[model samples]
Target: MKVDWSPLKHELGEWRAAGLTLPLWWRDDDAVAPTESLARLESLSATSGVPVHMAVIPRDATRSLADDLSDQFIPVVHGWAHVNNQTEGKKAEFGMGRDAHAARLDLQQSMARMRDLFGARLAPMFVPPWNRFDAALLPTLAEFGIDALSTYLPRQTATPIAGVTQINTHIDPIFWRGTRGLVPPDDLVAQTVALLQARRTGMQDNAEPLGYLTHHLVHDADIWEFSQQFMQEMCDGPVRLYRHDTKGFS
Candidate 1:
């Protein structure tokens, strides 16, 4: 399908005219091992000059994954096991109704395991499975050395608690509840334009970098093509890409 990217391009032009550059970043979740899909992701990141902050599930993560890391990949913790602990409601590895102590232990283990695997390469970021975590656990993140928390949608506050910074993914190309394929490209572009408009008009926090979320393992051909095209457009546009170590966070 032919996609109209002019809306996004026009929105970005407005940002440039205001002497502001949109801050953007990419995050790919559920990476556990090296695969062809991951190789493509790495290649795209390298080519686009946009580093991918990969959310690796600590429990199922393998040494091969650690070994396969390239300079374009930033590793972060993605819950303990990616398993659902809740008896009802949405699937979450660290959601409400679970014992707080157990959840803390899982987080602790997540940090320890990922640290051991990724070592100095790991960014101190926590991404709860299904992007759902008990809000009560926010304050305890610092105890496990986690300084950043990422989830979906616009974050209400920059710092959810005292020390941890909250950055969130704004655009997801997948139509999860329906086809499990790419959401219509026109819809995606519309969503992007709307998000940019909100930020530009101060309806949302403009300081928080816009995050592009992906699931490499699940991406079909259309998704991959869209991702590549989107990344290229953003990189070529009037935008600044963010990294965990960048002053944008400091």
Candidate 2:
């Protein structure tokens, strides 16, 4: 389906007129090992000049995956394992139903395993599985050397706790509950326009880099095309790409 990107383009133009720069970042989750799909993602990032932050699952991550990472790919922890610990409700590894002590141990182990695999390449960020994390675990994140927390939607505050920074993805192209393919192009474009409008009009936190979330392993042709187009537009627009080290999260 053809997408009308004029709305997003107009919003970007407004940002330029205001002499504002939109901070943008890309994150792809659930990476375990090297695969053809992953190679495509890496190639896209290298070609588009937009770095992708790979949310590598600690338990399933491999040394080869770490070796496959280029400067364009940044590795961050994506929970202990992608397993859902909840007996009821939605899937989540770090949900409220989990025991606090067990959760802490999981967090500790997740960091250790990721550090072992990725070494110093791993960013000090935690992305809870299914983007669901218990608020009670917030304070303990810093103890495990986590500097940032990422999830879905706009973050309510820059700092949910004293030491950790909260940065979240505002747009996800997938229709997870539906066909597991791309969401309707019109809806996706409209959502992007709305998000940018909110930030441009001072209704949202513009400081938090606008994040593009993707699942490379599950992406089909449509999703890949949309991702490339969207990344190209953002790269060509008034924006600054976010970098973990230079962003002061450390």
For 110-213, candidate 2 gives per-residue lDDT tens digits of 99999898888889999999999998999779988899999999999999988999989988999999999999988988998899889989999999989999
The regions of model 1 sitting more than 4 angstroms off are 246-250
Best by lDDT: 1
Model 1 scores what on Cα lDDT? Answer: 0.90
Candidate 1 lDDT at 69 equals: 88
Model 2 clash pairs? none
Give me the displacement of residue 72 in model 1, in angstroms.
0.5
Per-model tally of clashing residue pairs: 0, 0
lDDT for position 230 in model 1? 96
lDDT of 1 by residue, 1-250 (tens): 4678899888889988888778899999999999999999999999898999999999999999999889789998899999999999899888888899999888888999999998888999899989998889987788888999999999999998888999899999999999999999999999999999999999999889999999999999999999999998887677888887543331
